[model samples]
Target: MKFAVDPWDPTYGTSLGTELGESAAQVALDVELPSSEWQPIDPDPWVVPPDAVLFVDGVRRVDAQVWVDDGGAEAAPALCASYAAGVVCCCKDGAHLLTADVRRGLFTTADAADDVRTTAGTYRATRTAPHPDVAPAQLLSLALQRELADTELAAAAAARGGHDSVHGGADDLLVIDGPLRGRQHLPRAIGFVKSHRSDYLPPQLGGVVAALRTGQRTPVFRLGSSWERHTWYLRLPCRPGAPWAGVVRVECSADLSAGEAVGHAARSQATLPRFASTEYKDSRAPQNLYPIAGLERELRRRLGEPNLLYRALRRAAAA
Candidate 1:
């Protein structure tokens, strides 16, 4: 099944040639200027900045409008099915630090004894109850994970398809908010803890991964905002030994470099066939996306990739 993998917060609010404030921004996908819409392929031997890992596209300017079509005849549904999932692997606990510290340990006070413990630098109160540092960090760790129950792999393995659908029309597509562990993200983040730490994947991923591999299906990873606000950067798949594999950067938050994005797309398009032939296949490299069509047009104008406009025109013709 043809799959399109996109991260939840791939757009960068910061600016061009600049990075985000979070340390995770270190892993952002670099953008470049867009290519000419008149030509299909970008200029050969395209020049790139020496430090640029991911280049921007050619079209640095953009304008787009949604074209609504209401046909009388029955339109064909997606040839296959679609599904979506969002996973919150980590949580943010900075807000509740003070309230947690003020009520540390058992004192049998009038109010519910403050069982919450917070970490150092978690808040700005500059006051603490002389508790251990581990307590606060542990407390702060529950922000993203607050919703996920069945914490043990053995307790129940995972919660069944609780809330996996979010896409507009996804009958044949099954999308996950995080990696399926069939890829490289987890192994790198938590390390291979024996058989890689999948205890955090919440079981749904386990069943999905089993389906993808057994059916020779391609699964899409849609890294979400829960991870975005903290993690900042995400991964993309590259050809094994392709020099850029395991490459990651902050999501889409940098200035546009002249042809980097398109070059990378071209590279991906050309590399797909060869990459498809390899056993070490993956689709989790870095990604650049804009939630707002205007932002996408501006960025695409800068980088020169106008797949949006072309797709629109094609639809217009079929109409």
Candidate 2:
């Protein structure tokens, strides 16, 4: 039997089916699925002058059971366990782990020193309401996740500085797994978007996205919304499935000149394809680069043994 996963949608009883049908129809009419018509880019030394490429991503998980006063029935006290980690690597050399930040026992509600760890990490207390409707436990979990992301970015930046000091200001490129909104000033840094949640391009430009081939990339263009950045699409090498299967969007700092942006595009086209993961190596395959995959595993490991942390939290909360 094929297992299917469904999102927690309140509209499932109402507009979910209608929304899906409309979305499918819109994709058929407006968007063209990716094809193998992209411009092939040769690996050029001038394009990728960086000594290393740093891949940065964050992970967070909440253990509501950590302090389940009433067996996690309703409005129970909870804690968010979060951590951030970074990895830096080059094509020739493997990955080097960076210092990670871990925060545990972040309280879900406003309480005065409810637990030992919570009291130690005094900033873990949630004062303001995140949302009027969301449950307290969920809100605290969301807040912890946001905090984790910020910490990851900071760790990534610190790692870059640390690497520079060791390697004598080597020109290293940083590839963050999400949008580079707050990190606009990071030199030689680019955001790597894996999923296609929204159509950033117009109908005319949809063909350009569709034409991307393995190890090929689209032309650089300005992506403007709340934040602006020079972005391009690159299809990583992978076992063929669908047109857009291995496509990843790369975006660089908008503060750069046009030439610099184009340079970043070229660097991404050359560098990213080298790190593309195969189906055998990763479940996510090409979009989840090798360094990134390893980095994620390392981060989770650094987050401490899950069972141990949970038990400790439970015991501390009971005290």
Candidate 3:
């Protein structure tokens, strides 16, 4: 088969370099960046309570059609539909014992017909119904899936119980797969960031982050954004080359006092590395914890037979 390919000219490399250089320069604008000073902490200082921690993650897939029409002469909108699913896994004695709950749903752009308009910095109001075509529908589908997944985790956190109480504290930790975002306020919850966007520290400090040894973590530092949190980087045991080869960022609510924040940091340094996946088990091993990888597989499996679901959606639209 003949394929057209975009030619890589000399200008391409220069353009790419300029973009990356600007990105690195932009890091300085993040006033919340941590100081260059930091110290390494040992992971052995803490003990994880049995069956008191939960890990949450989600998965989604979209099925679309080119041209869809109602049963009669009525015009049919393009169908962009998907299944969004999430799972909550409870940890016990350094192992994920069982799935506490599974949440999933089928969503489509057609359902956005009655959505009201709103003006917000982060939210763009959809005044008109979404187009049935793949592009428009798929965008709406993805947004819906993300919302559902976050909602599921929030519900599970509520049911599992909060971190501590005045009468007696609940010794549970909620480890979310990605940034806590809107869910940061959840009690005893923390966000696990697998990918790094920009440097959150100066070069010298970042060097310390890169040099972190297995089971070692950087000193906890406060990060301010639209939300506030204490953040640190930890290294997992893995075959490594670069400084950040096995490093991952962990974030906890800044609402905690200094002592409490340090305690949570210690618990994470000890608990997370134990769940790190081997290179043979995952392409993104070490950073992608084994329990999270397993939970992702389980959620995708619960999405059901894709072909069957696709045909059902088509049949329903036709009818």
What lDDT score belongs to each candidate, Candidate 1 first?
A: 0.21, 0.65, 0.59
lDDT (Cα, tens digit) per residue for candidate 1, span 1-319: 6543332222432111132123221212222211111112222334322111111111111112212222424321110001111122111211110000010121111122122222211111111222344453333222212211112111111111221122222111111112222212211111011011212222333332222211121121122332431111112332333221222222111122224324333333222221111122212222222111222233333322246434533453364
Clashing pairs in 2: 35-210
Candidate 2 residues lying further than 4 Å off, grouped into runs, are: 1-46, 65-77, 91-93, 105-123, 126-128, 133-138
lDDT of 2 at 78: 56
For model 1, state the Cα shift of residue 103 in Å: 24
Best by TM-score: 2
**Model 1 root mean square deviation, Cα atoms:** 25.4
TM-score of each: 0.19, 0.78, 0.71
lDDT of 2 by residue, 1-319 (tens): 6542222122323111222221121221111124233344444556645678888887766644443343334544556555665655663466676556665545555433343463223225443354679986677667676676678778877888888888888778898877776777888899987766666555565666556677677766676666677877788886654546677878887788777887888888778888887766666776778878787787777666666666666565676
TM-score of 2: 0.78
lDDT score of residue 6 within candidate 1:
30
